[model samples]
Target: MERASRSNMQSILDYTDKDVRELHEQALENLREIGLVNPVDAFKALSAKDSKGRNTTLLEIREIYVSPNVGTEDRELSRIITLYPEITIEGGGQYSQLVLTFENNRFPDMNRIWQILESYGKESAEYRENIDDYPMLQLTILPLTLDGRYGFVMSSPIMWFLTPADPAEEQPRQIRMLIEPGGLQFVQDESYSVEKILEESRKMMASYKMDLQRQLDKEEAEKEMQREMEAEHKRFLESNVTNHTFGYDENTARTAENRRQAWNDMQKDGKFKVGNKRD
Candidate 1:
């Protein structure tokens, strides 16, 4: 009986080892889903010093424009949206307004801020797993600078390759609107065209723009109120506090008297050398 049990265990091990090659390939696919695709490329893409690293490419993009200081005013610059007329597999996606803040506290009002994010997104887009299927994509440049480094975040709704690839015989369809939970699993509709996707993307962008406009309005109102309050305070001080009254004249007289006394004493002291002033 012990011999039979040993034989059974040996047979189980043999069966498990039968298709190691297929098992290895499946394991690699699973590993890719969890994100660790070309670790060397990913690491080099993120490295600030490695410009011409192995198996990696660098794309330099710069945004050149003048925007009104949103801390004070809003301009028509943010209203410009892109429809992506030339839609490449790697290039064209319906993107919302590219809102850039033009202010002095940040970079100068009209300086080209380098955008190296295309290379970053190209390498790192695979890691951005979808939280949900609802897509809201925008290329936003914030008015902020620190330690001479201005940066941007690579954002997308799916873990997609942003760079162009060799045209495939059949490309995967765009993510369709799921009416209910797990709707995608049950349905595979082929009706979602590029135009439809662009239309939906436009709507999403419009909604985002409205929300942003409201926020800008609120901020402008607050700034106006603050400026008014500051002006009022200045006016009040001007009316109430005269130079001759409120001890202002007395303080000035006392300071001048002390300085004059110091000068007289220094003049009398023959030993008051210039070197002594340092001490």
Candidate 2:
């Protein structure tokens, strides 16, 4: 008996192992069919380093012309160039706007400041409207930080005319900086950590298993309820049916007995015979 119990337990364990293996295989097939791969593996496959052990950097620039007036252009030009260390002046027509691009081996120190301006520009309606007149700068920078701890900043200068509430008042021009940061390696590092990804996957699998178990339990409960209902119906029929027949009720049995008795009385009265000769 002890050996038999041990064999049964081993069989159960084997069945569970088979089920787990099948589930994992099905999950892998689904991933392959959908062209989905582990994030870490995909990242590693595309990872590369340059000769300097850094990614290449690219800069995008745009010049927005808000109005024809050039009152503030000269005053703002000096300050804007001073703010950005890599700024280089270029000649432009009377109506043309100036834009500059710069690339360096080291990450720019003004990247943080540009990020702040970008955030502000996203929230400003004036800046958005000005962007419609001038295209936004879009660039991809390479040679990311060696330690994957740095980022890049790209921005464009915008000029708009600010008119006083009164029409007779002088119209003054205003200039605003629009900036955006890219290649945020530090944030990606935290989000793409192996431990974090594994934790998330485990949580997802646990939730799925819980949902499957709940569905199975619901189906089992429904089947048990149906069986109980069928049993109760059978007992009810047995109690109500006076005869051993399945469908006949007590009233039907009584009616059949009465009919038989009437036939017997008729035979005794000679109105009917059990076996009559037809001659």
Candidate 3:
């Protein structure tokens, strides 16, 4: 019966925007009417209003932003954002600007949802290759998973802004993979359920890191070796020139002279400086 319930819940995860919005509205309504302040900061923070007069509390929504390079486009990003919740960064409220999530775990606190949001924003900045921009959107809960397996998830249409697709003729590009570690970063060997996947991913990442280090070391060694060889060759030439000793037997010297004469004869005439002397 429990398993069936879980299955049913999973099936409802893709509820349409209207469906999710209704549920989110219900949750907010419950919170407002009940005056529940268990997580007081988050309760108040979520109630903030923006210039347009719509905020998370009023609309009961979350907003997810896509790559700015893609611009505001629903068709360009809807599939990517909705399909890959595991690796997506989530944010909400006033502290929303400073948190990031991997799984449901926030670096600072896990029990508190508001702390989790702040942590998600912080982590996003921490892990991002570029910190100049905050890319996470305001995400609210309904179909959202608080399972600690994802940093954040959206439950309704009101919870996110629809990314507008460009009208330009160019076809949108598809993401090959979620390069960011995302929730996978939080898995530890101790978690019995997630241990196997976590361990394997760790091993693979370790191997790749080691291979990269080895390649860098090899390149450095090769460069050093080349430098040494060059120095040795230069030294050898210098030593030979300085010593000015042709370590040749009488026969070898005679042969060298004969070749020299042959080369001299090949030229139409000799062009020599006035003070030039031949040994």
Top-lDDT structure, candidate number: 2
- lDDT (10s digit) by residue, model 1, range 152-245: 2223323322221224523322211111221111111234322333344355446645665676687778778777756654443344333323
lDDT of 3 by residue, 41-84 (tens): 33334333322232222111133444445454532111111211
Q: lDDT for each of the candidates?
A: 0.29, 0.32, 0.31
Displacement of the residue 81 alpha carbon in candidate 3, Å:
20
Question: The CA-based lDDT of model 1 is what?
Answer: 0.29
Candidates sorted on lDDT, descending: 2, 3, 1
Number of colliding residue pairs in model 3 = 29
Segments in model 1 whose C-alpha atoms lie over 4 Å from true places: 1-81, 84-190, 242-279
Best by TM-score: 1
Model 3 misplaced regions, further than 4 Å: 1-148, 153-193, 242-279
> Taking the tens digit of each residue's C-alpha lDDT, what string does model 2 give over 1-279?
001111111111222334434433443443355353432322232223223332212122223333334453311110111112222122243222222222321222233224434543563435543343322332212112112212223334343222232455443221123232321121223223222322333454355446546766877787787777566544533453354433344465455554444444544566543222221
